[model samples]
Target: MRQPENLIEINYAANQSSVDVDELGMRDMQRRVFAEKDAQYLLVKAPPASGKSRALMFVALDKLFHQGINKIIIAVPERSIGASFASTALVQHGFFADWEIEDRNNLCTPGGDSGKVDAFLRFLEGDDTVLVCTHATLRFAMAKLPASAFDDTLVAIDEFHHVSADKDSSRLGQVVHEIMSGSSAHVVAMTGSYFRGDSVPVLMPEDEEKFTPVTFNYYDQLNGYKHLKSLGIGHHFYQGRYTDAIHEVFDPDLKTLIHIPSVNSSESTKDKIEEVNRILDLIGTFEGKDESGIMRLRTPDGRVLRVADLVDDSDLMARSNLLGYLGQVAAKDKDAVDVIIALGMAKEGFDWPFAEHALTVGHRSSLTEVIQIIGRVTRDAQGKPRAQFTNLIAEPAADADEVTTAVNTMLKAITASLLMEQVLAPNFNFKPKEPGEAPEPGTLAVKGLKAPPTDRVRQIIETDLNDLKATILQDPGFRRAAAGQLDAEVANKVLIPKILRERYPDLNSAEAESLRQHVVVDSVVKAGEVKEVGDKKFVMLAKKYVDLDKLDINLIDKVNPFQRAFEVLSKSVDPKTLRVVMDAIAETRIEVTAEEAVLMYPKLREFQRMEGRVPSIRSKDPHEKRLAEILLFLRRAKASQAKVNA
Candidate 1:
């Protein structure tokens, strides 16, 4: 068959005119990306409807026609998707005639015909044609082709996550490693998101000396939805179960969109048919145009019908005729919304720019799949954006918790994809925002920003300590220690000595000697179960002589001094000596209120709270939870200080 002249003309026109390339949109960053010579691979990860494919299409076309490259290969997971991509690119560039696009199932080589294996080899041998196929096809092709065949070729792979290594088997991983190893081909790999550690090896194998680290960037536009809403061109979501709530929240002027998922199973098909018939009946009630310029109902139900069903004599044909008749009804009825029913055939490659709302009412496999379905409504038109409201009728049995996780995961994946493309691809760029399009002052730009540092590890330890302290201080027995038993020891051992030293540093030698004599009763140290001779120990005579009524003391002085001493001693003291001193200190007596008990002990507070009682210091696990309680008390004290300053 001779090549079509119109295809040739279109190709020639595309090469001569800059329309398609210009329409690719945004050039600044893409030009900067192309300038880098050291970059080994380009990774593009973009959200659905973010113009990733369009940008790539222009770049690929330019490189093929303008650059010296002889071959350009585009590979993806699905054959139909690949063909659709190639066809769109060719049609946009007017290059349809010069390309022989084929799926893996129907490929031909000059020598051996019909197998993708042979045909890919033929293309690799400087055949000067573009090859668009699946990743599996390329893998087989690579196995047959010699290493030299990769020279100067641009290889693009879409949906790259599918080729990632399975945890159980490394077969796909090894294949990717081999293909990328020592190849001179300029490669571009695209994916929504990559597993944390899985991406580096697949795209840039360590064994390959020429590999470069992957780069990323992101694009998120709030303007798209805003523009669509302003134009009043699309449907808005009405909460399916709470329609009144939706009405209360949203303006009545907005159009409503109802989304119904496919009921593809045999049993559900009957229900789906009935649902479509009911929607058709609803359309009959409108007198003229409703809030949405012209109301429309779209369902999926055409593939099951034959191409000749439009003119068939059977009753099935009459039902099949509903779509055309409905389209006519929409044209005739001034107030009517367009109603469409497609049988599993309307989703892929379908673009309805006017669609403003999408209501999802069924199960979905992945977040990416759901986004793709929703993306059908989010296209940009003449500076106006598409799609506003997305209403999902969540089934109670569909495991909403898991669905939420998957959706979040998918969104992250989309963000990661855009980031990769922005940072890595040389010929990719985003347009500068027009005046007044930037964020308002003081508003945070969270999307596409680098992550802030997390202090979670430190916080976890501190929180655990605080909790423990709160529990321990709530015991009645613990409260006794808090009251005043340690007060005498703390005053004699720590407070009086420190204060006396600080205030009267110039005391005469004779007075100091007299004071020391009065304070010390003996010089003796004891070993385990043994009385040692001539070892030094001090007993304060001031403890007996000083009048307790003359000195004012606070509870903090007693508790804090002992706590500090215990902390200091624990570090240097032998375990046996530490246990002896701890046992003696544990016998000390103090009094505490119920509030003070809970405030001082975290475990006690927790126990009280758990038992529906006020937190108390008198708890059984006083020692075990003392640390948390003390910490909590200290925190509250600090907070009080802050408030006083304020």
Candidate 2:
């Protein structure tokens, strides 16, 4: 479920955890992450359950116990995630000392507070080696205390996504910057997710370079799993809100965690009581509160199902009973938690090992939210082999005649946009060039670099590739190659390798050649580059497809996940047909004054007759749409001018 759209079987040595040196020894990435201990600042871009908390422990311990660091402050977004830094078994694993987080200093638990603002100053004045505090508390304390007060400490921030360059997050960001500038405070920023939906830089370019980055790709983590096998991400479209179609995706047999839509979500009616009642009814007969004030419910088929309501009801007893169950790691009774209805809880650090499926009912626009929900079910439990994430989105129900225009263009677009991000990481198809030759169109071949490449430049081409996505199917040369119009010998053995090297300059001649063949095989298998082979069933990559049962993992690792989907999408719709749609939506350019637009009203009427609807000023609409806008604008301006004259 990690960037479900862009899962590759690529492995990194850092992903392999080192042996348990003591008891709970460091993971391979953890071992490698610690090797950068000498760095003044570090950014560990690891995946969920990649033992980031433990890694931070080893580094913080080194800075405190070994290095001459004065103090260590750990900040997390939520109190629950603070438990990640709780006392560890590291001493048993041969570390110099175990991490002992005092309950009093653990602001997450009940303790003295002028808020944590006052406690933070007290802790800094004392000799506490490590203090775990939430970002809000730290932000508040930093306001009260001088930046120098936090100097000489290693300040580690978890769920680092919330710390960004935006003004909303600037409070904590400025505080961290101030503390670092005032004194020599080192920072270890950690986040499981890469990008925030709003597209703000987490750290400024120059500020970011100060930290050494250690990345553990999702493919590496899930691939290295001992018990968990494959992770599946799917989208199920239903009529109206998911409330209208819960039965389609929900399975009582699956240990599911359903993320009900927020009030703002299109699927949400925003009626919490109605939402709860509807869900309870779907599962079973809601027989009111049991002896313990918990809701007792039975399914339509006579099967007993225990449901825990995470939403607070107006009734104090019902709300209090649910609050009592808020932070429990797991339900005490085995049969008690068949389904836990939650909002704003049970996510990001709450562990539920029994979860087999993570289901959400909404259009979760944020990629960070999507990844976090997936993490809910990915935790490996004994005997549990696979996990799934299903997004139940509202599909518009319009009659066939209105499918293209009225049914729900916006709805489908939103759904496709969400799925596209999961299916494909924004891609840039880069190809390397020969000496003294030009780079491939829409690709920047890194060549003649006096110094090594930066992650930024490389990432720009990779993540922001959509703008420059190549028109492969439309290219004459590629089309000829696909249609067998070109000579096979020259096309396959020579031209393809040249293009691959041009696109991937990092790949040497041999590597490029290998990739070229793989790309060609991929192109042909997709039924785009090669035709006349009826019913293409096999796909050959780095190696030839050998048998039905086995696949070469190494070659499979390099296969692009987007190509299969791309081929189906591309082949289904004719390019010429798409052009017609574009023409239908295109707006004709015009130069007209307010008076002139009035004169063109009859011309606008022609469009209304032709299209069978009055065109409006739409950025996405055709030339006729612009005409309507122009006429309307002119009429308004003319009216204003007439008023002035009078």
Candidate 3:
């Protein structure tokens, strides 16, 4: 039987502030971006379904009519997302102007790139004010037209994380660089997740610094929602085929979207179409396909389910018909589709507002993809008070050669949870405690928390905190540290700063330290508990309760930022399976370096004095065992030197 490991469950206030409209008909996130409508290079980092598309429309219209911009070019990652930037009636909602686009201006319809590019070029030369196209079309158009052709245009890229800083591989990135470098064009970049999977940055440091950022985190979007009050992210572990255990987590009552594993992934059955059929059989008795190709299933309880099958691609015409029907029906009626099972089509920019659950099989290697999939079910809807995301993974077998891979996948899943917790929690404002001064209502005053000393550091801390944490959590060194292979302080002080310097080479030493401290503070604080006791609030720092007034950076540095992940793993997984995971990690433990030996030598002497003998590898304490490993490492090095001398 597969059991769910509900790692993090967050409850929001649901104050209905996010959806509240202002006089200009803008939601919270849109209002924030529209305030900075004058920025030539603006980046909006908000969650999905937070009115980001309309925010772009608001800003693009302002630029086109008032900001001296001649034309607007909105490019999306795919044709499906192009629908987001369609014509709008802003004046009906209290704005000064209305957004209108001719039918021929939207190049996202079924068309070839060559033709779209030609249409794009024609629009650029004509008197039209706005045109929508796919990113590929923009790339193709840029190849033929010089950058000067877009001198007075506003280029807005949706799902902007797809544009990487690597000029060698990403033609869209090259197109952006060319346009910005050779012409005086206003650019807007928007994305749900700012970080990428491969750790390659989305933009160069210099180029990123030029943009003014508007960061509306997940907390703001969810906490201010009118309907969604809570969200839960969990993992379900199955020993054998995932299909055999799908019923354990698949709840037919909840509106759901299921993403089957990719064909190349380890958990995949290698035949997606057959897998879809098998899932349908497991759900209920399959009746037959409807006129629009939707799979109809009759459950044991005598209820019929309308399931959309996107994995079957053998018949293009039938699939097109199914897609067209889904697009039209999903918008108007909540009961039009009961379930949507897709392989790779419905992950990004697929809007299903009534979906209450997003179930995924197999570990998604990309955190961005995971976030996007989670976004599909997070939209606020009537009668939907909660959203849930569950990842179904295969448990490691004792005799399997790929046990290491399985363990890595599990650790990545855990880290992704940790990152999501940071994303979903409310923002913290940590300030230095002053003598006889009272803290603000929602702020924390610490004795030794270092304030950001530079504006550059401050900006990064304010806007790029989650992105910075994402980079750190994905680092190989941090992964080892999270697995208990390295000391906590070393991870906090050494490895973290090294990563920051590499990520932002322009930061001075002081700025880097400040940024590193902010990261540690934010992660540790979010992972711990905060409770109110009478007039004083107490925070749990490394299992000990400390007054919020006395909390300091030194106290925070001693605790591992990832301690909660390990603790959650211990409680979530069975003892035997956890032992398997730990043993697999131990097999590939990092060797003790000389610098680490220097750090551990004092602990080694202290252990000798206390135990009246050398530390033993069989000890129950992890640190004591670590000292023993260091001793063995030194002995081996001495022996190797002796052999060389001989």
Candidate 4:
């Protein structure tokens, strides 16, 4: 049995600063958001288990009492997440008031849609200050109630990525647009996964610009932890059914959450309940369910493992029983459960602090879902020194027609891991180096790094760097470049700017270039290894060591941001499988567009002038090889055009 490969292993500082509460019962992340309470349109992007719910309470309470907001309408993606906003006694923890929602006002409980919507309307009109409901309920309620009904209310949407800018497809997003456009309601959007997995913009550029972003990055949340010291992210590929290969990566000793593939996915066996039972049998002999409905499995050894089967939701009673038990699990009793097998229920907004390992058994299509699943195990808890996320993917068969799809899925998984690497590492403050300027501590200066030319660019660099990189890593062009099919410079100078302009259409050429430089610089630096030799530190960029303090933007741009992912892929998978992956990529990789050819033509000429010869396709240099490919592409285009004319 092959063990899981560790692609990204990041250790935190364990400073305990993030978990520490301030005078107002707010954790470090909460306090950061609370300070921006005055902004009517605020977006708080924080990692899970970072007290985003409590942070909303702090801000909502302030808005209700001080900001003249008449009511607080809190909407979550699902009903279970409403519990995060359940009435809390904040005054006991040194706050001005408590966050109390009357039972009737808490519209997230089990009930009919019409009844919940009626209750929602009653609460909005009545004297109640806070109401909790799911996004579906809110969307339904908004249909019945005019946008004016939301006037003077503070609407807070949790897991905000669910609301897309595409109003036609996203009803919740349409409701939000209506409220913002037709009424004067204050809005606060919060999300653990800032970027959506579907690649849709959560908000239109104009609407997003209205919100003042308060970003509490994963690095700050994890690095300031009290107990969790490190996080490892990796993927394992199995030739056949994943159930048979479970033992390869499954560790019974760790408190784990196993997310089985959805029945609809190709990787699934199509029988979720049977899959769960198969996993149970593999683990040990099934003793039976205990009184609380949690399955009791006797391992090969004497130890009995408590498994929660969320996949078998046909038995509502048993599912409810397990949910109740999981709800009571906390830091005090970290070992209340052993493993959880679920198809889809326990990803976002599901809190389990004791979860040390999240073993996901398929390629998660959404980066957002991956982030949330990882969040389940990242909570700070006593005795839980480390957290892990493992992706179990199906290896592509060279003979299969779906091999292309399989290869794409494999690359997507790799990209997700790479993005997490960027997210989990410590945040770096990068600046343009100035002549004779004194070196600053904790700040990285790169020669020729473009400084932000506008406030909009500055805001993007400050809050949206990871999100930008997320989009870039997922781009087909960047992935091909990372696989060594194209030049790193083409990806850095051409493909990256294209994404930036499309995402932020308002950006001029200069602004887009500035943002592009920052994205490339940040990614390349974070992807590189930092080494300290004696008193001096050096960073390995493009496989060459460069003085960390004297780095250059040009040097960083020459590096493939996903180079580490490629290296990991080469090491983790067998060469045959790797060949399959490469072949699939080459077969489907986007040909160089005429626009991209136009962009590279000048650079190709410059290369020819500098080297005193046209670049060779067989050149060891990626940049030269890319130019050679582009030259060939253009010549083929010219010959095809001439033939058409004749």
Clashing pairs in 3: none
* Candidate 2 local lDDT, 1-646, one digit each (tens): 0112312212223222322233446777687688898788888876677788999989988888777898889999987688778888787766667877777678775444466777788899887777898988888888787777766789998988777666575687777677767878889988877555444556655566566777664555666566676566665545555676877677888777877877765567988768867887787887776644456777777877767777655676765556455445253334546677877677777667668788777655555666677777766565667777776655333333333231122223233333333322212233433477644553333222112144544443333222111212212233223222223333444444444443444655544444444343333333222122353323344335532122232333334322333232233334543333233223222234444354456667787788887767653433444466666777788899999999
Off by over 4 Å in 4: 329-332, 598-629, 640-646
Model 1 off-target regions past 4 Å? 1-38, 57-70, 83-117, 139-152, 167-175, 191-350, 382-386, 394-646
Show model 2 residue runs off by greater than 4 Å: 1-24, 111-113, 287-296, 313-336, 397-646
Whole-model lDDT per candidate = 0.37, 0.58, 0.87, 0.86
Report the Cα lDDT for residue 289, model 4: 78
Model 3 lDDT-worst window of ten: 477-486
Once model 2 is optimally superposed onto the true structure by TM-score, how far is the C-alpha of residue 506 displaced, in angstroms? 22
RMSD of 3: 2.0
Q: Score residue 620 of candidate 1 by CA lDDT.
A: 35
lDDT of candidate 1 over 86-169, digit per residue (tens): 444245434322334444323321123236666667666645557776667776776666655776777777765455444244
Better of 2 and 4 by TM-score: 4
lDDT of 3 by residue, 26-79 (tens): 999999999999999999999999999999999998998898999999999889
Ranking of predictions according to TM-score:
3, 4, 2, 1
TM-score of 2: 0.66
Model 2: weakest 10-residue lDDT segment is 1-10
- Cα deviation at 559, candidate 1, in Å, is 34
How far residue 632's Cα lies from its native spot in candidate 4, in Å, is 4.1
Which 10-residue window in model 1 sums to the lowest lDDT?
520-529
